[model samples]
Target: MTATVAAPDKTRRLVFPFTAIVGQAEMKLALLLNVIDPKIGGVMIMGDRGTGKSTTIRALADLLPEIDVVAGDPFNSDPQDPELMSDEIREQIAQDLPITITQKKVPMVDLPLGATEDRVCGTIDIEKALSEGVKAFEPGLLAKANRGILYVDEVNLLDDHLVDVLLDSAASGWNTVEREGISIRHPARFVLVGSGNPEEGELRPQLLDRFGMHAEIHTVKEPNLRVQIVEQRAAFDQEPQLFSQKYQQEQIELQEQLIQAQKVLPEVYLDYELRLKISQVCSELDVDGLRGDIVTNRAAKALAAFEYRAVVTVDDIRRVITLCLRHRLRKDPLESIDSGYKVQKVFDRVFGLES
Candidate 1:
């Protein structure tokens, strides 16, 4: 069964085009980096509601290239192609013959807040057993999201148990099951995407650390920008196809850029001086755990890749500091200034990315 939102006003629902979205440039940049490097963990967007969080994610889905996946595999594993699948999976599939595949837009499976445990994780196919006396396992959200994205809108509201499962699968790249007389483990690697209003609740620290990057955003403030958003959105509702068509060419261009960036990412070089700076910033902030340094380095590399540069620059590092380090830092909310700016001060004294 499909979930429905509280509101019935459906025709007016238009995802603001990536090009059309005003402001929030930082948020957009962080998301783009995650696409270039899935190992950056995953992106978690925190902000007030109606800040174009979900819309931005959906827009990315439209912008990204569809990937090839095994035709009947619930986990969306790649077929036995040495170049496409990882060496481990490639070897596993080599023993199996006649693998099949088709292109699919990396799935963005929305996990509803009130979903049952059985629904989130697979359950035995009781229908198959009752009717045919044969035990067949059924897959769940984790399985369906393999090689794609798993999105949680009100992520902070999710139960701890569900969050635990998400962490396990995300860290291991496989979802393990020992339920209902069936044991299964399959590849469940996915980009775990989440968005939430911080006012509602706090995301668990353990789960929060799982995300590769973090972006903070809010609705447009300037009246002109706000007006433009409303005007374009209304125009889109007046004629959906025409509005979408106008932006179609731009989306295609963005897609091409993304493809080029992906191809160039591995070539982006990181030197020792930059690594030392990243560690110094994190250490000064008193942010525990080494994930902060790892994420900062990864995010910087991704930004460099996006810029079509072969070397990661100080400019790239500074551009990504806020989103990558904000949540990880131990800070007092009373301080109006953000940890990113603090890192910035140190950066200017050291490498001078900004004037």
Candidate 2:
């Protein structure tokens, strides 16, 4: 008998395609909505280690379309989006605009596990003035994320102050700088995608509400599935180009689905009963505030649109309720997952899902 040797794994050489990722249905849905309705805020994935949480998000940038942006701006705002312009700049655009544009990939700028406050938020250009006697406002990660996705892995571990900066900028859609006698404003609107292992610490409730959806991803332990994953991944490591070529068709098909979904999303209808059900479920669960209602509606509408449905339904809402409510649930003094599962069970009874 002859023994064959196996090739080494090389998952880091290239980003795995978003379409190629398996499982984590809610996570996938939330991200899809971020693309369809950037106003739904951002997707937050909280889960266990080795669950493919980060991989799914990193791969998403691959499926998005290239955007047209102003030629000189670091924040890649759409030349046409009004938020991109200052009042004066808006006037200039209004007055027979001289808007120069170029198409670029929608960015998925990563906030490293540990980054300084000054670097994450823009700071004044002291070096420019000290050396050349000229003042400048250097952009930061927040600025570059405009009209893109700002991704933070291990988000719960981020400094509280930095988290505040992110939330405020996200809510306002622009960064305000007031330091070193240089005050400036620029577009900072971007979907904030945060992924973390929940065992470390819980994200603040106020901050949690800001995320439009939350998905809990767990590792796949199935024997057959795991075997396939390892084999395909090892094959790709031995032949990168050939592997990507094989999935080229799959990527194209997924991209087409996304584009078609985007077109229909604007016209997708939210039914009256669905709206009532959303309110009822939120109240039943005793979840705080109105963001829950808003996110539930948005996620359901987006899910329907993704599935090529023309109208929202209970099924759509049920699929996304956990994603919208898991992080926003009021804290229990006892500390348990029951509060979350209880809400989900209530939703099932009211909305008619598998009990």
Candidates' C-alpha lDDT = 0.77, 0.78
Q: Cα miss at 193, model 1 (Å)?
A: 1.4
Q: lDDT, candidate 2, residue 294?
A: 91
Which model scores highest in TM-score? 2
lDDT of 1: 0.77
RMSD of 1: 6.3
Q: Which ten residues in a row have the lowest lDDT in candidate 1?
A: 1-10
Q: Please give the clash total of every predicted structure, in order.
A: 3, 1
lDDT per residue for candidate 2 within 1-355, as digits (tens), equals 1122232344544667776666677788888887887778888888888777767777788668767776665777566678765444466667865656667768888998688877888788877866886557777898888888899998999987888888788878888887766677787888898888879987888887888887777777788877777777687678867877777888888778888888898899998877998899888878888888998888788888888999987777777788888777778788755655877788888878754
lDDT of 2 at 258: 81
TM-score of each: 0.86, 0.87
Deviation (Å) of 35 in candidate 2: 1.5
